[model samples]
Target: MPDNRERDRKDHYLPRGFLKGFIDPANKDLAKPLWHFDLETTAWSRESPGSIGWERGMYDYHPGTNVLEHPDEVFERFEREFPLVREYLLRRNFKGWVKQHKHFLLEFAQMMRARSPLFLQQQTAQNENTRIMTVTSVGPGNQVGVDTTVPYPPPARFIRNRTITAMREEIKKGPDWMENFHWCLRYTRSVADPFVTGTQPIVVEGRYPNSNDAPVLEDALNDHNTIIWFPLCWQACLVGAVDRFDEGTAEAPPSLISHVRGMFRRPSAGYVISPIKIESF
Candidate 1:
């Protein structure tokens, strides 16, 4: 059998199995008619979960060996437990949930943030610094001296490794801080305008745009003022608000869908994923 590193050459940041839930319910074809909209290009296309939202060896820490790092091992576990979350979303159950369940849900949301390309770029910029070296050469006697300077950028691998290390640390702490927040499972009454997700799926409402660093995210998670929205599937969305209570199984109004659809444009996401074809989100 192939080892973990070789199991998936194309690693999906957003779990492939999880995206399958967004497929159109009416489409009985095996093609899995999932709609993809490009926010930048204003173009749309049909796709399957396995064909999109993946990169070549994004999680392969080691290429020539069987060694797999924290991301692969950790993410695999989350995807495995996705079915349980799916069941929960399907039944719309709001009871019997323990702290661990809530914890994993929080961690999974953080992982989605960390795994995003934009987030990775932000983390890389935060971790890497340029090195400048200056050399002064003295000429014979009182001759003029020349100053030579060279700049060396940090290696891509070095920056990525450091970012990954920090990502591991942050992913662990994010969920813990936000565990006490009121979580609501909101569902759409119609599949016509199901919930939409994207490359940067987790939206931190009312927070500064592109301020998704660990410190900022942790602050948002801990702060009762910030609201977080996570699209679980076409029909369901997971919401976090510290002040709101008595939020049980409730119908997600069309106005709410319009609100989320409006959000996909801000900060400019790479892709907008949904069950129905959205002409212009």
Candidate 2:
């Protein structure tokens, strides 16, 4: 029999079992199709021409065992933003800090990557049979409504009966699939501010753009089968309840909610740490 870790890990990967039910069927049954983008295939740069002084690649971390490995490359940009943040540690005076907080920091990075479809989509693999659904907001600004839907199907049915349970089952099948199936959904009103920042009210494209095709919000919300309802139940495991709600945010320490909004921004350059609260059935 599998222990809780094994059982929980299993639930984390497969998209058809627990995940299917975990995401509300009505939400999943929408008409919107999923959108997938290949980060390696596209050219990514800072979203703004003059946006400066912040970490360049802080938002690109992926979850799983390899989560720590990305710090070296991404941290370079972080150092550029805050030299003292890293310099103080290089002296090794904070070995105790490293010991106690290293894992927490890594987990935080994973949450950042997990929250962004830009990063999350990059981590996903192609499966013609498995339908992909994208979950993101709609409209000119972040005020846009949250919608769901299925994506254009592949040549075959690699996946069936999509759900959070099934998504978790798929992840446990192998270690490499860790970052593909899950996401952090932290939707809040204040976080929507950036999405609707400009005054002209330009027709905003979908938050996530895929290499294959850009599926707009209206298209995504229509197909529920492809949609995976944001799973709130899963958030606690990645981020503790206290830090997630109180201290982490665009303001007030910024919670995962703020990060999720940042990741969904148009031409998002960096990543934000969003709290993923997966809803339980």
Per-residue lDDT tens digits for candidate 1, residues 166-258, read: 666666566765677788777776778888888778877755554443445655655666877888777778888877757555778888878
Q: How well does each candidate superpose onto the true structure, as a TM-score?
A: 0.78, 0.20
* Per-residue C-alpha lDDT of model 2 across residues 1-281, encoded as one tens digit per residue: 11112111211111122122122222345332111121234322222211211233223322221222222333243224322332343244334433444343333333322323332233243333355554466666655443445455542222211222233333233323222323222222232221111101111223334411332234433332222222221121122211123322112223533343333343423221111221210
**Runs of candidate 1 exceeding 4 Å displacement:** 1-8, 62-70, 92-100, 130-154, 212-225
Q: How high is the CA lDDT of each candidate model? A: 0.70, 0.27
Candidate number of the best lDDT: 1
Q: What is the lDDT of candidate 1?
A: 0.70
Candidate 2, residue 2: Cα displacement in angstroms equals: 22
lDDT (C-alpha) at residue 49 in model 2? 12
Model 2 spans > 4 angstroms off:
1-95, 119-125, 128-281
